[model samples]
Target chain A: MTAHPDQTKAGAGRIVISVDAMGGDHGAATVVAGIAHSAKKNPDIGFILHGRRDELERLVAKRRHLADCTEIRDAPDVVSMDDKPSHVMRHGKGTSMWSALESVRNGEATVCVSCGNTGALMMMSVLRLRRLPGIYRPAIAVMWPSRNPQGFNVLLDGGADIRADAKDLMQYALMGTSYARNGFGVARPRIGLLNVGTEEHKGRAELREAHDLIAANAQTSDFEFVGFVEGRDLPGDTCDVIVTDGFTGNVALKTGEGTATMIAERLRDAFAYSPLSRLASVLAYTSLQRLKKRIDPRRVNGGVFLGLNGTVVKSHGAADPTGVSAAVKLAFQLAQSGFSQKLAARVASAALPPQDASSDDDGGTS
Target chain B: MTAHPDQTKAGAGRIVISVDAMGGDHGAATVVAGIAHSAKKNPDIGFILHGRRDELERLVAKRRHLADCTEIRDAPDVVSMDDKPSHVMRHGKGTSMWSALESVRNGEATVCVSCGNTGALMMMSVLRLRRLPGIYRPAIAVMWPSRNPQGFNVLLDGGADIRADAKDLMQYALMGTSYARNGFGVARPRIGLLNVGTEEHKGRAELREAHDLIAANAQTSDFEFVGFVEGRDLPGDTCDVIVTDGFTGNVALKTGEGTATMIAERLRDAFAYSPLSRLASVLAYTSLQRLKKRIDPRRVNGGVFLGLNGTVVKSHGAADPTGVSAAVKLAFQLAQSGFSQKLAARVASAALPPQDASSDDDGGTS
Candidate 1:
């Protein structure tokens, strides 16, 4: 095999990330711009851009650096943000989202990044790539901006599917821990089961049983169990990964995002309230920018779907180029570390023999 | 009955609120100071202070307004924050929390306010006052600061009990609507069932059934059902009352509080980053204060326990005088509106025939 001079210098393998340049609220131009941003920052990254060939070509033509590192796959159709997952499974034959996942499934790319409908993306990914062996359900794990030494926490089952039994939660803990290790390079991630209270006797029956299961398996799983944690701990430094049913995790994720947005609006309104305050804002502009940088949602943009046979990162549908780049960057990192293979091996080694398997009826609905 | 000059001028009846003065983190001094603050603002308010007489007397000594409006009732025991609700129930006869609830039960006070252990307070309230007719479960409703014209939204069951079924969620909707209408004067309050997504087909089976029940009863129940709402809507104007099971409500509440605290600390740090920024802070101090006051949890301190025979407001255990005063003020307003009776009437009128009453296994556990 002939090795490129660039690859030899870094001595790291080249990573080809599949990009679905369609269905984002901002459209394909923004996604192409994001590819440009990633290519400018990391020379080792390559992309197989999935969208209408002519349009992608025009957009990539503007960025010569990105064009050199990009491969355009002619997917004639686009998945609308409002497209139903089931409908997409039947009709999304030549859509960018479909082609994007196909690349990962066919070994052309190690990771797929899409700023598309999350439900549709998950559905197509599952149909094409399948669930990892012994994995009951796949969960969308996202990085929560936190006060931890690593500056983030991993929260999963972020609305991949709403229902989880005691066993599914255990899987989430293992999957989340694996993601934290491969994606963030955290050694022996601390896992916390999200509950209403930190006490043992609190929350539902399933949560209690799941707590015991996680604690019992933590050592063998190569992670530390921090027991039950409340929603407040999502952004705290006490744990690296918070595992919960998708219903709660999704609500908490949206709640946190909404809250951050609300505060940002309020702060802006405060600064713009009076002429004197506006003048003060000018003086403190740099400090305010630093604060914004610290809490920027765009910096932690990707929601990586774990417990699946292949890696797929779901960028926010409304993401700008910066947000898309953040998602692409995460995909690159995970792809480089061979996250999919490591995750499969972890699940195969640590997962219990599907005890109480019948309890997962509620999980398969959606 | 002869009316006092203070009561006759307002043409409104005087309200006597029972206070559990012993269990708060700041003790009787803070409770007395809160009463003083409330009494100074509203002439028609009175209090029945429950605690050690000598301790209460010393704290009330400096507050002339509180002294005139207060009636002391000696209760020797106190319910510590860590005390289990069941333990408190078995041996809490002389505790201030017990006495406070008893005052409401015996018709000596219109409302009860306690800054004690929440689980203990909930247990005592259920034990002494009992659930209202046709109500299967009682819930704790809190005021979340929002962008609504009312400036706040109502959220419940904020840790009253963790488990809720379909019928219980329907009852929460009716009860929360009643609270919003009577307590906040929101005419025909819009109710939203809290879920992972606003889609009709999302969430657990219970939530979906509850959505249908709420929608079906909206016209007859005298409130608008806004369908399912996400956690972001808790702080948004789209809904007035967000109804959910206690587990989700409690987690969302704490998560919002934690996020707000994190942002506030970051904002402070930003302002203190440099000398020039410190000077800018001085200039923007007033605007910042306004912003702070707008989102101050203390300003909306009380968590009103609904669907009970009597009104019970649980203040934060660590509440300072300002926070305590806010809870007291809420209790007084609720008392004046005859909110307890109104809620009981609403529950009695709107509740279904308790079709799935057997599902409430943990309803009375606390």
Candidate 2:
């Protein structure tokens, strides 16, 4: 995003972010605090907070600068984290999540930010904003902290749908590349297909065909196809975007997060093991804080929906104010760069090969 | 295993482990050193070391106890890590990996432990030892360090074969439970079917059917069924066995390992960031070392082949002496407990559901 963070003046030029304020674990107050944090950091951002008017207005009024740049939309209902997507789709009329996405659908907001039930939010997103042309499944791309110079890599299909075939995988490659380009300003992104091994003969049959298909499209797509990458490469510097089906991608994403959290916990325990260690921890506190900042999940908190007509950032349902603020910053950046439109344009320009409307032809591996 | 550590006598009642000394990253010396380490700790373990005669003799002779408990089996060939499984199956009759499995096939050794190529070892294992009757796919179940009472969880298939259906996953559950019972002494182990979500409505179609099938057979199989666990649960104390297809399992395994390695690296960098941290590192050495000992990959470094007539342990290709010793220790435990016969008996007695011979019926998710 070329938008500078210093532009504190709020008015018509501000990029509007539609937020579903009712669904997060900490309630609307936390969401309002997150909005306030973003408003304090970046001057050229505005928000349409969707929730109960009295509560949201009271929260927003506490932050005068936030009040100057924010409008509260009255959404009487709330989408609980446990609500089924089917249930939500059937009777999700005045819910805050729906109201937030509707703002994007009606062109009243550049993007929508929600910390609701992921499945329900995604379902409502497809129903309201719609999938792009020639796209079998829309994917949710999350920024994974990596060893890359950009400090993060784009991993797609973070659980938009459980299954993806050869054609769907190929579409993911295109969308992921476009995401890296627009979101991080990477000139020419490198793409890798996630598999069991880097060998061509390995993995299931669909992955092999996807490998060939992705490699074949590399030249025209204007991205370097790094053939195949194992799960280890997800956090490594081998590629800018790692693509896979939602089942595998979601599992890997959570596995990585869980491992990181476990290690951090262990490190904390190690520091607290003895009096000497505790003293050492106090002495090394600054460095530990620095390390914590580098690997903090809250620092990179949004999973942006790709292949949809409009962009939506799915913040973690349990996110605190800092996490929410980071997600808002991401939404602001994507809106500033017009990520959704460019992604749509990229997919339209480079249509994937039609091998399997259903990937039933690959009988051997899957 | 109930094997006593103090029974270091090399004569009668000794359990012989077949070792492939030709194929690890380090030479036969390291393999011999690992054997010596095991011998130093446990006296009732014997070895049939497969490699070149002269080198094995020289390395074995350096440690008198290891030399006394070991017999050299001269196999003229070596299986490089890059050798294809199919190629090794056809032309690898006299290779050390081939020779190592034959010992188990002929009942000369209680179990086989190899630091050779995993795919080749698995191929040779199936051809030589054969799969247990009624078992469709032989899986490689790995021990993942976790917060379980046993300090680890069993995850399979660790890339034995990429695709697994509802039936395959059911078999994995059976095999994994048996493994936990024998390998970790976890009686009536809890089995979790890996999925995108814990909700029954989530994940691939095969997983849902597998969930039902595994749930139904839990009581008969004598194990607790924890339905639908996500990737994060692998490290948690929720279950003792995590069952999934080879592709997902393999990816999760490597992804977890990679995350650990990256964090460890960052911690090192963090400690080295400044003079104060360096001094703090010195002060916290013992606590840090204790933490390292708890999470070291080498401490739990074996992928046990399940559902085979004979047990086989595939050590990592780049494993060091500590890693090799860990694999040897696991092999010893399995061998002492007659894990192979018990697993075969368990599978033959409690059969899987009859959904799909090839899982072709599930059209929705793969």
Candidate 3:
């Protein structure tokens, strides 16, 4: 679906993003501050801030530029982190999250951004915006800070659905490649199927089948299929888009983040261990700060929900103004570029013919 | 089976480890150097070195201690890295890898350690030593360098079977907990079921079933069940043993190692960026070295094959002398403690009762 018909006449007009300014761990103030930060940086960005009208007006009034470009919607309810997705789908009406997504669904906004419960956000987005045609599942693609030249790798489904079959994995490849191109500007993204080992015969039978399917479609899909890649390859420079089922991708993402955090903490403690080390820390302060910034999780804080009719960016619930702003920036970029429409077209074109039992051998060559 | 029945009277005597000095990427020299390194540190360790006699004798002759402690077996053929397990099982006779495991099968050594083809070694071990009773699928358990007090966590099955059912995961729990207790001396080891989310409602159905199975038998199995732990917990201080199906565990293990290595290289490059950073490098050299040693992959360099009738340690194919030595140390520790027999008893004790059609609901309380 395209944006408002009136806005289409202006080639470089403002893009409005619906924001759910409630349910974040840091409260509504942090979310508003994030929007203010984005508004100051991007002149063409506009927002439909959904939350309590009085609070939204007060926060926006504090930032003149944000107030000029913002519209307030009065939504009384908030989605708690513990709310069940099913419960949210069934009874979560009039909530800020719901109203924000409804803006995207009704052509009022180009993209929807939320710093709320991920499960509830995903559930509400799918229920309100719906899935794309021929797309069985909607995957959440995350940007993993990586050794690639682009400094990141796209990994999905990052906890959207716990399972993916050969067909689903092929669909993920199409969606992830589309995201990598639109989201990261990688002209020819390298798509890799995440397996236990890079070898052809190492993983499950389904993976082998998926490999063939992905390899068979790589040319038409306009992506390079790097065949199979191992877990260690995720943060390495081997592939641009590391495709896996949601279960494995989610686990790998959190594990990598946890390990990086632990090591950073240990390095900090090591620098403070002795007088000489402390002196070294002072000398290495600039370089260490640079390295820290390069690897910081806050720099890339959103997980984009793909394979859906509307684009949804789920920011970390505990995100500060900087982190939330980073997410809003991504949502704004995607919305401006019409990423949802492009992704839908890619998925539709890449959709394989219905398979019987015998055509499985077609995905053999990469 | 007791080792060298004739030496039974000695009681607290030396332990012999079967060594397959072939199929490693570093060649036979690295394996020999690894043995020599282990022999220098340990007085009560002996080896049954399996390889070509001429090459073995020449290498052992250079190290007096290794020559004194090693019993060389003349095995001309070598198991190639490309050899399939089924092929090896049928026609891999007279190979160094086969002879090495035969030592353990014949009770000549307490444990078998190999730097050979993983698939071939797994097949040969199961064929030669057989599976422990009540163990349907054998698993490869790796020691993951972690932030735990023990400095590592035991994760399995690390590519044993790409597919593990509920019963297999439960077995992995028993086997992993047993390994953590005996290998790391983590008394009353905390066992966690690896899942996408920590919540009871997340992940595949089998994980839920395994969670119930593990939790229900924790007291009897003598492990502290930590409910569901996410991938982040793999390197965090949450659990001692993280249990998952072979596929997930393998991917997670490699992913952690890969991410750690990439970061280490990036950190090193950051320190060497400029003259000021170079000077900072010298200042932080000692502390950085300590941090490097704390997270070095070489320190914990072996994947122990669990749930089998005999103990087998698979060293990294590209390991250097130091890496190989770490694996030897692990093999020596397991041999000294008679870990294989203890594991057998644990498996037998934790064996599930015969399931009726309706009583399969036992694994649901957690």
Candidate 4:
């Protein structure tokens, strides 16, 4: 696959985002609406929607103004969220996700966005675009909801590698730091290893080894190593970046997300319980909106799979048009900012010598 | 290190819970108050409080009614929560926590409960009590908050084994199941492995293997296997028992506790901001109390560390008198039920022929 820098014939700025239209619960309607909304706001952006021709046409026909900014490519197969990663890759020949990812690989689009099976999207992206040299496993980096919107924590391998060694953890730190710096414009991002305690030699064997490797690495010295952080610290803006194996990270991320949603649902149910409560809810509309904005997943929809050669953003499966639009904007920001290129350089520089590597390998025994 | 069934004279048919009175933030005062409160309600319960001579006498003098049910044992040192686990064990001979556990080990008390440094407690307990004949690593089993009052989920290895393989997971399942059946009085507990998905091959290699082993083993087969469960299912009473390694389990448990507290704090702050809101809160005091009862951590304070030869419960460090009282009651219930003995018999009988013969081998890798 070659990187081709192409200019759109429609006279929009040369960047194009290939979206898996058939992905997520809402399917093509959400992607089409989100694209139309984003294109109207940012006239420089264009989209290539990949899905079944009939459904794509029907969704597009509902929005006449989007005809100029949007185009559809036929990709009949759809990958469900429950599908196995290998199954998706093996059977998803002309699937929307496959085509969307291929568009990024072929440089027809600057970035690819999907709200499909996260594992499948990750596998397909790494398989299609290939990993950057020395990057054994690509990581999925997410911005967790924090008390300070200006400072969000980055967590990688959200569901990628089951068991990661110290070397993988170091790579995650490097990639996550580079992402925070380039994508979010944070300077000298403070990196932390997620553990039960902050003390040295506190966590599992791999974390202990990773701690030593991170402390000794000269290249990572440019970024701040803030030692260990607990689960409570993730929401407090204690560190700009926190790294862990995919299993723990995924559980923590999902737990946070589910808890937020559960609380919101409970509040809604509480308000609907009585007429007096409903009136009080109306009276407290402003305060409620402030709370909503604080916990809104839409405000943090895009989760970038860092360490991959090409840019791939995974949005929430249940995201509406607004969330999808935000995801697209975030993807564009990451791609245009050259986040991947910067991360590649940082990881290359941080690579440890083979002799020193022996001390860090814990046999991936998580 | 012989197991002494009678180290102290039986003072009535009551169960004595040895408490490290100097363990938590509130010190001997809270422990004395909790013991007094529990003793007032349950005349059959007694407490052996361990702490410094001066502080113990000072606190005990204030509560005259406690003299009938409580006895103070002086210990020279106090183990700070921040102290390293290994260092604390090496130098904790006369510490309050050490003395408390010693009381249980010598059969002076039926159970030992602490709200102190968890790592130090685990180290001391394992060193003093020793593991069960076949048990490799002891696991901490906690009751996860569920929708049904009678239905509570068990999470094992809550912060014990940082690195666990298939065998560890299997042991956690077996031990947790036994706890649910004995502690919760469930006829046959339904066990669910905490994983990202319900598919057979969803989790890491260890989980996959553990799932197969549990399905094949007759001891585990008696209990209903509900398959995989996510973090969201924890509060919904989807399973009778939930199992995972310590690292993930600890994070999930703490995250739930912290998030719930954070939300409650936010609500209180919101209500306290205005006189009118404060008045409204006052008017809704009864309803608020009901809500508090629904989510009270005090209702579930004691977390039993299963896979041991005897019952040992770890209480929350921040627990109040009410929480401490609940922990003491729970410890008494576990001992009276004879859960650990029955569990040992079941585990021994269900093991493979070779496993039964070689059960004494200590260093075998799981």
List, residue by residue over B1-366, the lDDT tens digit for candidate 3. Answer: 244532531123678888998889888899999989998998778888899999988998999878878888999999887676777878899999999999888888888888888888888888888877777778999887788888888888877778888877887888888888766678899988899767787778988898888887788878899999988898888899888887888788877787788778889988888887888788878989999988877888899999777899999877888888999999988887878888888776664657522333322211
Model 2 residue pairs with clashes? A8-A43, B8-B43
Error of model 4, residue B246, in angstroms: 1.4
What is the C-alpha lDDT profile of model 2 across B240-272, one tens digit per residue? Answer: 999998889989988888777777888899999
Q: Looking at model 4, give its docking quality level.
A: acceptable
lDDT values of the candidates? Answer: 0.84, 0.84, 0.83, 0.74
Interface RMSD of 4: 2.9
Error of 4 at A249 (Å): 0.8
Task: Sort by DockQ, best first.
Answer: 3, 2, 1, 4
Q: Count the backbone clashes (under 3 Å) in each candidate.
A: 0, 2, 1, 0
Candidate 1 docks with a DockQ of 0.60
Pairs of residues at least 3 apart in sequence or in different chains that clash in candidate 1: none
The TM-score each candidate achieves on chain A is: 0.90, 0.90, 0.89, 0.89
Task: Tell me the spans in candidate 2 whose CA falls farther than 4 Å from its real position.
Answer: A1-12, A25-30, A58-65, A351-366, B1-13, B24-33, B54-65, B348-366
Each candidate's DockQ score against the native complex? 0.60, 0.66, 0.66, 0.29
Q: What is the TM-score of each candidate against the true structure?
A: 0.89, 0.90, 0.90, 0.86
Distance (Å) between predicted and true CA of A95, model 3?
A: 2.4
* Model 4 pairs in collision: none
